[model samples]
Target: MLFSEAQEAFKKHLIYREMSGETVKGYMKDLRCFNRYMTDVYNGAIYVEDITTDDIEEYMHYLLDERELAPRSRNRYLFSLRSFLNYAVKKQWVEHNVASEVDPVKVMEEKKVALTEEEIDELLATIKHKIVKFSVAFLYYTGMRVNEAHNITFEDIDNERNRLLVNGKGKKQRYIPIAKSLKPHLENYLTNIRGPIDSPYLLATKKTGRLSAGYINYELHRATKELGWDKNVTCHALRRSFATNLLRKRVDVFKISKLLGHSSIKTTTVYLQLNENELQTDIDKL
Candidate 1:
């Protein structure tokens, strides 16, 4: 089948598997880029039968050399293409799963960047925009992922119980406790700043409905750049900083895991590694 034909089949498979819209879009974009590369660079049209392991290798190089994509991003594009090829193989559209035969790219282990307490304070203090400051503070205190923070609604806040109902990854529902220290700020952001009960979201654009994850990330990025921070700060970094700081404060790992709404304690174990130096110091004292 032609590249377009293969793409349509992949889209059908994604839809059948109930993949999210964003996921589907990413897969489609990656595959199309591959198709374009074949046509433009090699002057060769790609068919399901024409796809080879060599082509897959060349595509990886193209992503790095031509597209200048980061290792992590290149891996994600490779993953999307591999999934499509796997689907095509199962459907008998391709002779073999060329992606499986291709050697996988090695992803380097990068250290997690957690903000120090002083740095965190500086970042917070640097935020002159009240709304943005509170948003950052909420993430710092709640240890919520960017998407989770954006998912917050007025109704989600259980003031009496001091908890937040969050729809987390995989559409899983969990309750995250709000620190007593954050209650006043949360109330102020809601009543004074957020304004209007027409929308269910705690944070909404004046013209639109709920704030998107992209919007939150963009604001954080702009603020971080303006502050001249050496390290690239992201919205998710706030969540990581919260977890790392809590671990530094000697908070129970299990409790921290629950507050972060991590399905497994293993997911929260990265913070333990972050504290390895401190952990060794404590051990030496003992």
Candidate 2:
């Protein structure tokens, strides 16, 4: 089959499988780019069944060496190709999964970035806008993901219990204990700024609808840029900062994992990088 024909088939399969629109678009775009590269570089057509292990390796090299794509991006391309080839093999279009033979690009793990206490204070103080300021403070204190923070509602705020029920990843429900320190601020925001919204979503847009994650991110980026923070500060960074600070304060990792609604403690381990003393103590015990 022609490359375009194969592309349409893959797209249809993704749609049938109920993949997100963004995911479908990304896979199609990556595959199309690969097909174009094959035609331009090798002066040959690449049918779905005609893709080989060598072709995949060459494409990876082209992306890394020629295009200088980051390891994460290179891995994403590999993943897209791999999924396509697996589908083709299942349909008996290809004799084997060529992508399986091509090794995935290795991504080097970097230390998770967290804000120092001073930096967090600086960030909070720098936000001149009342709404933005409280939003940042809420993120820091609650350790909520940007999406979860945006979705919080007055109903979710159990003031009597001092805990908030959050709908998290995979639609899992978990209760996060709100710090008593933030109760006053939360009450103030609800009473003054977010008055009588029909929508249960706590953080509403200016017109009193649920806020989009993009808007929250844009505001955060604007604030961080204005403050000239040397480090990269994304909305998710607040979540990481919360986790790291808890670990630094000797908070139980298992408890942190549970609070974060992580299915495995292993996922939380990444955030708990040991200090030199901890590492040395472990080594000395051996």
Q: TM-score for model 2?
A: 0.73
The model with the greatest TM-score is: 1
Best-fitting candidate, scored by lDDT:
2
List where candidate 1 sits over 4 angstroms from the true fold.
15-18, 39-45, 212-215, 218-228, 271-277
Give the TM-score of each candidate.
0.84, 0.73
> For candidate 2, lDDT tens digit of each residue in 1-286?
7777878998999988876566788999999889999898768876777777888899999998999999989989999999998888888888888898888878897655678667788887777767766787788788887777887877888878889998876567899998876777787887787667677777775675777667666777777898887666767777788887788777999989988778899987765655577669768988
CA shift of 107, model 2, Å: 4.1
Worst 10 residues of 2 by lDDT: 270-279
Q: Candidate 1 on 1-286: residue-level lDDT in tens?
A: 8988889978987778776566788888888888898888668776878888888898899888988998888888778777888888888987778888766678898767788778877887777666777888888888887767787877898878878998776566898888876788787887788766477777676777666666666777777788887666777788888888888899999998988888789999875436577778888997
